[model samples]
Target: MGAGRPLEVDLRRVWDAILYINKTGCQWAYLPHDFPPRTTVNYHYIKWMTTGFFARVNAEVRRRVRKKTVETRNRVRGSSTVKASRAPQNLPKNPALTVIKRSRAESIIL
Candidate 1:
């Protein structure tokens, strides 16, 4: 990917760092030690953000997410027959099952 371009730093790593900053709403100086210096991250973020690089990355991410969701839904639909066949008959119906089930489902989907 850097065949022709002069690679200075890892763009993905910088992007992740920027995302972490945005997610946590932390000051640049407060960036964790694992990431590059706050100034470096902030520099690239401002440059990229100004040039719409983040917008492009975001659009691509959304497209991939939608594609994956459709694929997963299709797989689940296709496996519905097997799902019923494998259903446990001895399972007890607990009232708290709904909450647990929802949490598990949310985790899996996310």
Candidate 2:
């Protein structure tokens, strides 16, 4: 019913949520049950996207696989990773909660 467990999240899951959100175009609260909470996932999404962390990762991976320099480059920085324990199951997974959470997260994006 309310936001629960303000904690860090797994980067892997965060990345997956970002991909899922982009691919599915679904609201964050609509994510599948296997995923971490919408808040956790979205929080990391905002953090990484703002820091340009994913851009660096893609460039590095592409360079490794293609054996060529990437046309687009970004500055690399030490991004601190956070590992949160499992999310509290008490809160119901619903769009209303994410709507509130996303309101703040959206400010960062814009």
User: For candidate 1, which ten residues in a row score worst on lDDT?
Assistant: 1-10
- Model 2 segments beyond 4 Å from truth? 1-8, 68-110
The positional error of residue 13 in candidate 1, measured at the CA in angstroms, is 3.2
Query: lDDT of all the models against the reference?
Result: 0.87, 0.74
Off by over 4 Å in 1: 1-7, 81-110
- Whole-model alpha-carbon lDDT for candidate 2: 0.74
TM-score of each: 0.57, 0.49
TM-score for candidate 1, please give it: 0.57
